[model samples]
Target: MKIYILLVITSFTFGFLEKVVSNPSPRPYKAIFNLGDSLSDTGNFLASGAILFPVIGKPPYGQTFFKRATGRCSDGRLMIDFIAEAYELPYLPPYLALTKDKDIQRGVNFAVAGATALDAKFFIEAGLAKYLWTNNSLSIQLGWFKKLKPSLCTTKQDCDSYFKRSLFLVGEIGGNDYNYAAIAGNITQLQATVPPVVEAITAAINELIAEGARELLVPGNFPIGCSALYLTLFRSENKEDYDDSGCLKTFNGFAEYHNKELKLALETLRKKNPHARILYADYYGAAKRFFHAPGHHGFTNGALRACCGGGGPYNFNISARCGHTGSKACADPSTYANWDGIHLTEAAYRYIAKGLIYGPFSYPPLKISPNKIA
Candidate 1:
C-alpha cells in the first residue's frame, strides 16, 4: 500500500458541503446495519455489562444528547445516529439490546466500543490486544452478527431483501487497532498492521454483499493526531514535528496513509463487484476541517481539550479518568470538539455526518437533503 499519499478525492469547505454530480439514481435505503466501534455504537457496551469503563456506557458520556448515560462514548448521538435519523428509521439498537420478536426490519448495531478490525489475537501477538477494560474485537462482533441470523430474517429471500434495502455501515473502525498500537508505544508496527485490518474490512464487505448487501458505507479514521488524547500523548518540544493545526505530523500522516490504502481497496472492490455501491466516507478530511474552524459550528475556545476527564492541559488524565468522583466537565459540552479526550463531541459528530451525507466525499453521488436521506 502507498505511504503518506495526498488525498485529493474531494473538495470541502468548513460546515458546508459542495455540490454532488449524479448517475441519476440512489438506493432507497430502508434500514441500517452498523458494524464498527464506539463512534457508531448506541448501547452495546452497556448491554455487554462493560458500563464500569465509565468513559462509555455511563454518566457524562451521554450528558449532551440523551441528557444522561446511554452507553455511547461521547456526550451525545454518534454519526450513525444522524444517518439513521436521516433515513427516518428509529435509532438502530445494539444487537445486545434485542429482547423479543419485533420489527428489527430496521436492523441492528454489532459494534462494541473497543473493537478492532483485525482479530484480537493479532493484538495479543503484539502484546497490545489486552482489553484496557471491557472488550470485544471486530471479529467477535461479526460472530455475534452471524448468530443473529435466525432473528434478522426468516427466509433466504427475506434476508436478501433486508440487505438490499439496508446500508451496511462498516467503519470508523480499524482505528482501535492503530489506537492500541500507538498507546502501547509501537509506532513502527503500524505500517505492517494496516494491510490486515483493511483486508478484514473488505472481506467483510464481500461477505455482506454475498448475503445481498448492495449499498455500503465504509468510513475512514478521523484525524487521530488532533484528538486531545494523542496531543497529550505525542506532544513535542520541537515545533517542526507539529503541523500548523498543532497536530503531530507523524500521527496524522499514518491516518492519511491508512485512508489512502482504504480508498484504493474500495476502488478495487467497486470494479470487481461492478454494480455494488461501495462508498468511502472521508472522515479524516471532515474532522481535520473541524479543528480549523470550531467556533463556526458553535464550539467555543477552539480547544481540542476534552470536555470531561481530570488533570493535564487538555483536562485529560489517564488515571483520574472521566466519570470518576473528582473528574470535571465543561459547563457545556457543545463548546468542545472531543468528549473524553478519545471520542468526539456530539457537535463534532453532527458536522461530520452532514459532510458524509451531502458531499464531494461520497461517490456516484447522494441525492441527499441537508437533513434527510434520499
Candidate 2:
C-alpha cells in the first residue's frame, strides 16, 4: 500500500448556526439501526473479511481513535457513532457481529462497506465473502428483523416492544450506485438508476415501519463531485463551474437531483405510513459547508487533494491502497475535508453528525408541531 501525502486548503465561510429550541417532550430513541457504506461501516469490513488488518486496523488509522481501530473506517469514530453517543445509546453493533448477549440489548448495524442501493457488482468486489447476513441485497436486511427478533428477545411480545423503541437509519447506501454510474461514464444512467435506488430505500423503510421503527432517520447522498478524488479525476476546463475551492458544480448538481428525488420518495412513504416518524438527513449541505469553509471548522485546505488516493482521474488509482508507498496521505487529515477521495475525515463526520443532531434537517420547525407532542 503506497501512501501519497497532500495538503488540501479551502477558503470559504464556515460554522453552523446555533439556536436553542425548546426540547420536545422527551421524545428520545432507544437505539439506532444504521445502514450504508464505508461512511457508516464501524467494523463490518474487518468482520466480513472485506479488508485485512494493518490498513484501517493499524496504528495511524486509529492513532487518534480509542487506542484501537475498533472497526471504524476512519482515524476515529464515524458519524453514526457520534449520533449514537449524542442520543446516549451504546454504539450500534455490526449486524454481522451480533452475539447472543449483544443481540438483545443494543441496536444492530446492517451497514456494510461498499453497500449500494441497487444489487450492483461493486459490493461483491468490496469483499462480502458470505451473503450470510442476507441475500446480498438491501431488501434482505429488512427480512432479518423477523429472523433475529425471536432469538434476541425473551418473547415475541418483547421483541415487538423492542422494535417500537428502535431508530432506523437507511442511508450511506446509495453512493456506490452513483459511483458505479460515474466510473462507467454514464451519468445519464442515474435517470434510470435513481428510481430503483430510491424504491429499494423506501421498501427498506416500509419494512422497518411494519416491524416497529417509529423514529427513522434517512440520510441522502453526499456531493460526489466535490470529492478530491472526483475533482482530480474529472477536472473540467470551465473553472467557473468549479468554485475557487475546486468543487465541481456539475457533479454536485447530480447529487442535488438525487437528493430531491429521495426527498420526494420519502414524502410519499410518509403518506403511506403516517405513524412512522421519518427525517431526512442532509449530508450534502453539511459536506458543502466543510469543503467551502475549512478554517472555521478547523480544516485548512479545502481542495488540495485527498490524503489517501492513488492514480486516477481523481488520483484514485485502484491498484494502490492508502498508506502505501507512492500513495498519498494528507498532512493532518483533520485539516482536509476528505480523508480519502471518497470518504470524509473523522472530524468531518463529527461536524456532520453535529449538524444532524441540531440542524434544520433533523429538527425542522414546521415538522415539529406542538400538537404532536401534546
Candidate 3:
C-alpha cells in the first residue's frame, strides 16, 4: 500500500507585466486559468459558506494580509494571487464569483479548498464517505472551466488567441484524495488509488491542451512527512518510521512516489504534445529547504510547530480548527512556517514562491522566453 497522500503548494512563474521579477522577461500571459485545491483557491470554499465544515472565511486566515478570512487557507495571498501580482494583475477572481467579465482578462481561479483530483465517490469507496466533499473534485472544477470557456471567446480565432496566450495552473491536486484515505485508516488502499488519480490529472491536461492551452505549470504535492497536519494525524513513536528530521519516513516516501509518477506523466505528455509547454514545479523541494533550514527564511520555530492552534507538538488539532474563537494568532507569523496545521503562512508561501520563480524547480526556465511585454 502507498500509505500516504499528496499536498497543495505555493509557486510563481517568472514573466511579464509593468514589472519583471527576473531577468529580461518573457511576455506575461494575459490570462491565468487555475485548477486545483485550497492551495490555489482564492475564495471558493468560504464563498460557498461551508464555515462549520471546511471552516474558513473568518479571522486568523487573513490575519496576515487581507485582515479577514478571504476564504484562502493561508493567512494571506495564495501563490496564485502572487502570480497575478507579479505581472501587475489584480488577485485572480474565483469562478464562483462570476458576475460579469469584470476580471476575466486576468484569468479565473476554479480551485476550491478540499478539492480532490478524483471524484468524491472515490473517497467513499476508499472508506472515507464521511469526509467526501462533492463539489470540490477536479471533475467539478473542470466543469466550471468548460463553462467559463464559452465566455472567454466567441469565434474560433479568438479562442485560439486567448488560450494560446493564457497560462494554465493545473494542480497540486490528488492530495485530498489520498488525505482522506490515510486519515480514514485505509492506507492499504493508497497504492491502488495512485494510478487512477494520475490518470485523471493526465486526462485533465489533455482536455486543457485540446482547448488551446499551450503553457501549463503544475506544482506537485508538499512534503507530507513534514506537514504538521500529517505528523499530528499520523503520530508515531516508532523511531524506525521517523526520519532524523522527525518526519515520518514512510509518509514522505509515499509523497515522493506520487511526485516521481507525476513527473513521468508530464514527460510523456510533453512528448505527445511537443508544441505545448508543461512544466513541473517541485513543491516538495521548495518546502524542504524551509524545513531543513527554517532560520534562513526567518522561520525560527522550525517545522515541528505551527504558528497557531493547540494540541500536540505540532500545535494542531483536528477538532479545534483554525479561525475559531480562542484560537490565537502567533505573535509573529513570519517566525513560523506553518500557519495552522494544514496550510502554510503567507510568509512561507512567499518564500516558497520566490524559490520556485528564481530557482530551477520551475522547468523550461521561467525567465528565458519573452513573447512580448504585456
Please provide, for model 2 over 88-189, each residue's C-alpha lDDT reduced to its tens digit, 9 standing for 90 to 100: 677888877777677446677777766667664533553432332222356655555557666656665775677677777888677777775666566666
Candidate with better TM-score, 1 vs 3: 3
Per-model lDDT: 0.80, 0.68, 0.80
TM-score for each model: 0.88, 0.80, 0.89
lDDT of 3 by residue, 1-374 (tens): 23332221111222233235444544567778999998888887767766445556767778877888788888887777776666656678888877864768778998988889988776666557787654578888888888878878988889888888788999989888888788878888887888898999999999999888998998888888988888988888888988777788888898899998999999999999998999998899888888888888788877768888865788888766676654666888878889888888888888766766566678864543332121
Candidate 1 Cα outliers beyond 4 Å, as residue runs: 1-27, 131-135, 367-374
lDDT of 1 by residue, 1-374 (tens): 23323232232332124333434234467778889988888888878878447456557778886888888888889888887777667788888888786567787898878778887677677787464434576667777877877777878898887777778888878998888888888888998989998999988888777777888899888888888788888888999988887788888899999999999999999999976799989888888887877777677856478888887888788777788867888888888888888888888888887888877666655446424532
Error of 1 at 189 (Å): 0.9
Q: Which candidate is the best by TM-score?
A: 3
